[model samples]
Target: MSSANLDPLSRNLLIGVLALAGTLASFAATTAPIQAAQRGAYEVTLPRTLDASGRGIVSGTMWCSEGARCAAPANGERAVSLCGEVASQFGEVSRFAGPQGELGSDDLARCNAAVVRR
Candidate 1:
């Protein structure tokens, strides 16, 4: 039978099936991991400053990494979160303004020194 002879519901079902198939094909094509291997590194830096309430302000850059996913926070801030394998090795580093009651130089050093395998 010709498509024009098909009922509205049947036509709609066919269209939906075709659209679904097209979407699945496109997704499969783009989702395959590229054979090319990407490698890189990053550097993070923060300013040594204190706020009125004694919270540390930090700013830094990340390079090599795919994105700016590993940089410190900006001014008027107290702390920032670090993560990934690097963070695990280096203990999460969060710079706070003022005197950290329990967190001191030793803690900072340990955290900053953490290294993670790629």
Candidate 2:
């Protein structure tokens, strides 16, 4: 009835089960943050009459223009994606308005600020 009385094979099997459970727990802990990071937050500035919820009816497709600076590894792409996700949730589709030519530091600052606000 105890580990001392169990056969060698039974003891090994119990150890293996315990090891597997520990491995699974550690794996979940490490991947939680990565999954959350991938789903970046986007703060959209809707008209004063509208909110993230589809309360105020905007009767047209939403437009989003990504600047050239967004292609960099910074918060550009993620913010745009977040905007798309939120827009879709509120029953409005989004289309990119081509590249933003001649982006400056102010552009990146505004983009990064939106993400932080989300």
What are the lDDT scores of the predictions, listed in order? 0.39, 0.43
Model 1 lDDT, residue 48, Cα: 28
Write one digit per residue (lDDT tens) for candidate 2, span 42-105.
Answer: 3334322333324322223233323211112124443444444444433232222223333234
Badly placed stretches (over 4 Å) of model 2 are 44-118
True-structure RMSD, every candidate: 14.1, 11.4
Model 2: how far is 77 from its true place, Å? Answer: 16
Model 2: lDDT to the true structure: 0.43
Could you tell me how far off, in angstroms, the CA of residue 109 lies in candidate 1 after the best superposition?
A: 38
Instruction: Using TM-score, give the best candidate's number.
Output: 2
Q: TM-score for all predictions?
A: 0.29, 0.37
TM-score computed on alpha carbons, candidate 1 = 0.29
Sequence-dependent TM-score of model 2 = 0.37
What residue runs in model 1 are displaced by over 4 Å at the alpha carbon? 34-118
Residue 29 displacement in candidate 1 (angstroms): 0.4
